[model samples]
Target: METSKVIHAIYTDDDVLMAAVKKVKANKYHIGEIYTPFPVHGLDKAMGLAPTRLAITAFLYGCVGLIVATVMMNYIMIEDWPQDIGGKPSFSYIENMPAFVPIMFELTVFFSAHLMVITFYLRSRMWPFKDAENPDPRTTDDHFLMEIPVSGNEKELHDLLVETGAVEVNLVNNTH
Candidate 1:
């Protein structure tokens, strides 16, 4: 079985890459992937990708963290070790609840940060101990790369890529 081959075109400027992407999208050519050093405004719309739902996930995780912190602190300080030692009273739920606010806030932030990071990594198919899958290393620095799988005519695709402002184009075959 033969899988689709990927051809990457590297561009020096983001504007040029964006124009190329827009042209390809307008031409109804399928764009396999795009890579840039930083976020490109309007790239998602050009690529027809749906809006990210990461913020919603973070909010849900924060709620979970808050509940966990509240329950754990309430049970431990009020139910399990109910005793008044400092004369200020420790068994009162209101008194100890205020003290738990700091822990609750910390856990909320911790869960949101860690879980959001993990979510992003997994969504992007990235993880620890995994080799980076980059077509061109320069795309991580000062270049923008577009990987398009050629389907019909190679010459037309190459011509379209060149005319749209690609600095260099190269084909990489993965045959086993």
Candidate 2:
């Protein structure tokens, strides 16, 4: 496969990085990725990224958890073996729903949290024992790295990044 050229621009401060992102977008340059030590609020919006649909997926997962809890409880307490507790016989699901509320709530939270984490990992190509893909180690601590594909106009792009307050700039040949 052919290798592609890219530019890595390092910024010391997130404020500068955020401004640079906006300038890059205004200039119509395509940004490959950005690595930051911590979450930078509004960076996604400045990068023009699409809104995440993770909330919708979490809701669906919560619903699945609720259904599973309901079925399991009904099977165990009513269908398999009915028992009297607190003077109420476990012969119906509706009458016993109040008691199962805590179980359903717990399961819903558990499924939503676990499934959301798994989904994020899968979508980001991150898994246990996976090698890190960060181009610069400093980006994981104090610096922010912004990657931009080079489409022959390397000088212009480099100059733009420098003007945008990049602390350092390096040209890289990226091989996927």
Highest TM-score: give the candidate number. 2
Tens digits of per-residue lDDT for model 2 on 10-103?
9999999999999999999999999999999999999999999989999999999999999999999999998998899987999999999999
TM-scores, all candidates, are 0.89, 0.97
Name the regions of candidate 1 deviating beyond 4 angstroms: 83-86, 174-176
The residue ranges of model 2 lying beyond 4 angstroms of the native Cα positions read none
Which pairs in model 2 have colliding backbones? Answer: none
Q: Name the lDDT of candidate 2.
A: 0.95
Q: Give me the overall lDDT of model 1.
A: 0.85
Q: What overall lDDT goes with each candidate model?
A: 0.85, 0.95
lDDT of 1 by residue, 59-129 (tens): 99899888888888888888888777577677566777776789999999988889899999999889889
